[model samples]
Target chain A: EAEVAQSPRYKITEKSQAVAFWCDPISGHATLYWYRQILGQGPELLVQFQDESVVDDSQLPKDRFSAERLKGVDSTLKIQPAELGDSAMYLCATTQGSNNEQFFGPGTRLTVL
Target chain B: AQRVTQPEKLLSVFKGAPVELKCNYSYSGSPELFWYVQYSRQRLQLLLRHISRESIKGFTADLNKGETSFHLKKPFAQEEDSAMYYCALMPGSGGSNYKLTFGKGTLLTVNP
Candidate 1:
């Protein structure tokens, strides 16, 4: 089975520094999602992409966070000037259709000092 | 706004015991419900969805429209069943714009 791939499984950075996470969705899956999961809480959607176009990003903090799927196959999420509260698990998921199962990646754990 | 609530943060049961994880949701329109599980060092994976009504790994969940609940249940829990479970809800037909609203999650520990 093809799984979503994420890099830098763990990251540590200080506040005010920049951090980035990468994700590659399953082949042919057009819809991709980025989520943040704080400790003791469930995942929260940060952004969604349909191909290379952003379908939704209302929850994303535009001032400090940005995500892009330039090639429509993989994506990159960046947070400039990371905050302490940004310490969380960043997850990437993908689905081929609206009703299909969303496959999740192992996630990138970010710890800001 | 749609929201999912899993009241119990932690649940423990002995092997072979019946286990139930409560999940409630608040959505005005018709919603699709799902249960996702993450075992130790494993990525989150779909355990089951209400639309399919299928039992997976001896676990089953029923959608109660009247009560706005979709609780996961299993008659005989095994030690390997210990994992963090999340209940999620997707509004409408789950089109491209729709997103999943997840509950805080429940940590199930099936002990020997």
Candidate 2:
């Protein structure tokens, strides 16, 4: 079974530091998404990419967050000057098209002091 | 704006008992609703979608436009069914594909 891959399953950093999370979607998937989930809450979309182009980022906090899918397969999400409020589970998901079944990765649990 | 509301944050049911996880949404146009489940130490996976209208793992959800709800229900619950479940909505008309919204989620604890 093909599954999405995420690196650094767990990360802890102090406030004002920078953090990055990586995600490799299932092979041949064209759509990728990044989401943040606080403890006891559902995941919220941060950014979405379709074949290397951003589809939606209206919810993304542009001030400190950035996401990219250069080749349209793998993606990276970065947060600079991370704050305590930024501590959450960073999840990556993928689908073949805009309105297809989404597959999610194991996620990267980030903790910022 | 699209919003999903899951009133209950936690639900505990005995094994073999009937279980109902409430999910409600607010959208003007036709919407696509889905149920995602996450077991212990596992990634989130789709349990069922309203469009499919097929029951999964003995769970079924009926989309009631008048009520604006798509609640998941199972006639009999099992211990292995304990997990966190989320109700997601993809507004059909004007909402973008990537603008899906999810509720806070409900933690179902099926006691044996």
User: Residue A35 in candidate 2 has what lDDT?
Assistant: 92
How well is each residue in B32-87 modelled by candidate 1, as lDDT tens digits? 99999999999999999998989999999999999999999999999999999999
Q: Give the Cα RMSD of candidate 2.
A: 1.3
Please give, for residues A1-113, the per-residue lDDT of candidate 2 as tens digits: 99999988999999999999999999988888999999989999999888899989998999999999888889999999899999999999998774557899999999998
Per residue, candidate 2 scores C-alpha lDDT tens digits across B1-112 of: 8899999999999999999999999987899899999999999999999989999999999999999999999999999999999999986763346456899999999998
Judged by whole-model lDDT over C-alpha atoms, candidate 1 comes out at: 0.95
The superposed Cα distance between candidate 1 and the true structure at residue B70, in angstroms, equals 0.2
Predictions: Cα RMSD each: 0.9, 1.3
Which docking band does candidate 2 fall into?
medium
Q: Considering only N, C-alpha and C atoms within 3 Å, which residue pairs clash in candidate 2? A: none
